[model samples]
Target: MTLKIPLENSSFNLDVSGIAGFFGGEESFAAMSSVHLVRGRRWLGWYNSPGSYYVAKKYGVLAKSRVWDGLYPGVNVDPTTMLELDGKVGPRYVAAHSGTRMEKTGHLAYLLASHYSDLEVDQVIPGPSAKSEAHITIASLEEFKEFEGYPKLPADHLSPFDPIATVPIAFSVGASVMCAIFGDWYCFAMIILGVVCNGVSCFVIGSGVLKIKQPNPSPHSPPGDGVLFNAPGSRVILLKGSEKIISSITRGRFFLEYKSQSQYHDIGYSSVALTMQFLLQLFIVPQGQLFGQIMFLSSLGVSWIFNAYLASVDREDLQKRILMRVLLQKPTFRTVALPKWTSLVVFAAVYLQAKPEGTRGLLEQLIPNDTAVWRLVKSAVVEAVERNKDPSEVVAERNLDHLDNQERGLLEDMMKQASIGYNAGNDFKL
Candidate 1:
């Protein structure tokens, strides 16, 4: 009597639009499977052949249709001989001879048949074998299905601020501000105390936030009982356990140390800003002079703005590093692009702030003379500057290249410095 097994129907249907884009186009999508609709292509071709349908119905739990293409080329092996062949022939040879391409049904049948026939089937599966190496058995099909989804993505969370550490730091900042306003010698003492507390808090918070701990594997069990075969040649066995643990731990340690140092620099810069503000208010602003007061306030505002800019730049640098790491690990669906509107706004601001020669040079390098956006920004800035200046102070057209050589040389030096900085090592110093 031929034994028959029922096919498990899928609870979820494939997202056709998403799948179509993923494979390149509708034609590529249609080429995926033999089944085609009048309007759209079928996701899986299992229904095209009775044998394929039967195998998919019976062993769908072993793999999903989307992932079947990857598995189909390597499904002919008897599980019992997989390890032996793998050790002698090497992985490339074993993978090459595993099966014929596009044989979805045959692959499913091979997987199901191998699982039932071989007692040590778990040891010889083509995919990940770390848990199997550790003698970890799936308690149910549900547990195995959990591991079969799309690749696990990294978490999006990035900030490492700890509220507990932040509270004390906030208190220190407040105390330092109060002391500075009163012009007390105790302000120096408070500043010193705040710096020390800032360092300790940053280290403690960063370590907690980025901690990495690996789970200990189960102790070895007797062979042929609960144990899977101990194949030292398996990639997972050699690299997944202790090696992964060590690497993660090292990475976490380095991140924490780096973040702590950045925080220290941030605190030191804030201290400098506070000192400048205090000195300006206490000694530079004369009691009766409006100009002295305006100058003092301007200096204080500029110092604070510079400090804030440095902190923001550091954060952006860190975010870029994180994004690079993530992209290295996963396939990206689209290239990142800067919005045109943002570019325009930033260009307008830069042009308004820059010296005319410097602005003109930047425009020459950044945009063609005929570009509409550049023209708009340049005309607006030039009109505003001319409107504010006295007619007598307005420079003649001949001085349009004012400080031309010096500004161009300065701009080139700045560009060179930026290029060097970007190409330098990832280590960011304040």
Candidate 2:
């Protein structure tokens, strides 16, 4: 059987028959065969035959296998025997297998659509096209929306304010003012501490803001009660308890909550208190007063610990959401401001504190390794390390191919649209 997936300008024909040897009646045959086929295709690695086996079994194929023999290392298998199973399977097995394969293909299409362009999958029903052979029809975004569970195309919402990037510039100006006014080591140290606190605070606060902006329903609030207001203040989607909205919001919420926090209300309180205390010291206290300095430093320390604890708790919350989303075969996305400032600050911090060159080791030491925030920081370090290596070594390590002309064009178009929307939003703000 062949699957025809529609793209922006053309269609992609997936020759399932070409990979028929990868699927067989026996669990071992299916598992090993698929691993071999997708060994180097890291993006497609998750769709290996063993994963398909469970999917097929769920649809009532090979119901007798109770023990879950997970994916195995690739090995040579009899191609002819696998082909025989594909061709000679009984009607029940054939139907189950077809359903399973189509489901997997649908998932693949969804992933591609999310990053590249909107796409849809439809089984070619018998009629005029029956003579053409069984195939999957890729539908346009408009056409795809008719199907169940498929979401609306992401809105061109302007990305969020980058507190991280802006805060550092603000801090530098403030530091210069202190240097001119106080001209002491204590003032210099306070400047450093303030910048560090602001950077870390901005990172977690930006993540929390993005989480709130995500097109997810509030767990505590009922459907229709939750409103998703996008960045740049252009779009608002009122959510309802309907399957479509709930499913989309639930998937999105699960991920957002996992990477950040379920709700940021408590964190907001802490931030407000810290900000107020800092302002009090800045405006009212004498510059040389040790008591005011102590109070400010103590508050900063407490805020750092509080934010770190929240970040760690958010990581645990995310793990639970991930398990739920995986089992449900659903995830979601939303377009919000890019939070460029936050990203810049976080990246700067990560770069300074990465292993072997711990210029700002305090940040690393403060953040727990187990937290999601730290994991992101680690990934950034690894990416930077990879870029510094030989070009050939980096290419080999990633094994990623350059996008073709068609894909490149589509991606460029998507980015351009986003850029235009962002600029427009900024203009409105100005």
Top lDDT: which candidate number? 2
Clashes of 1: 1
Instruction: Provide the global lDDT of candidate 2 against the true structure.
Output: 0.27
TM-score per prediction, in order, is 0.18, 0.21
lDDT of each: 0.25, 0.27
| Model 2 / residue 4 / CA error / Å | 78
Q: Write the per-residue lDDT of candidate 2 for residues 335-405, one digit (tens) a residue.
A: 22222322222222222222323312322322234444334333433344334432123223442245566
Model 1 agreement with the true structure over 1-430: per-residue lDDT tens digits: 5322111133332221111111222221122211110111121111111011122211222222334324233343321122111112111101011111111112111222233222333322111222222111111111011111112212343333222323333444454444444443333342333244323322222221221122232234111101011222211100111222212211211111224242233323322333333333333223213322222233223323322332233332333333234322211111111112223222222323334443343333333445433354444433333344311122222243544675546433333322222222112111
Which ranges of candidate 2 are over 4 A from the true structure?
A: 1-174, 177-182, 185-191, 208-255, 258-285, 289-430
Error of 1 at 257 (Å): 5.1
Cα deviation of 278, candidate 2, in Å: 2.2
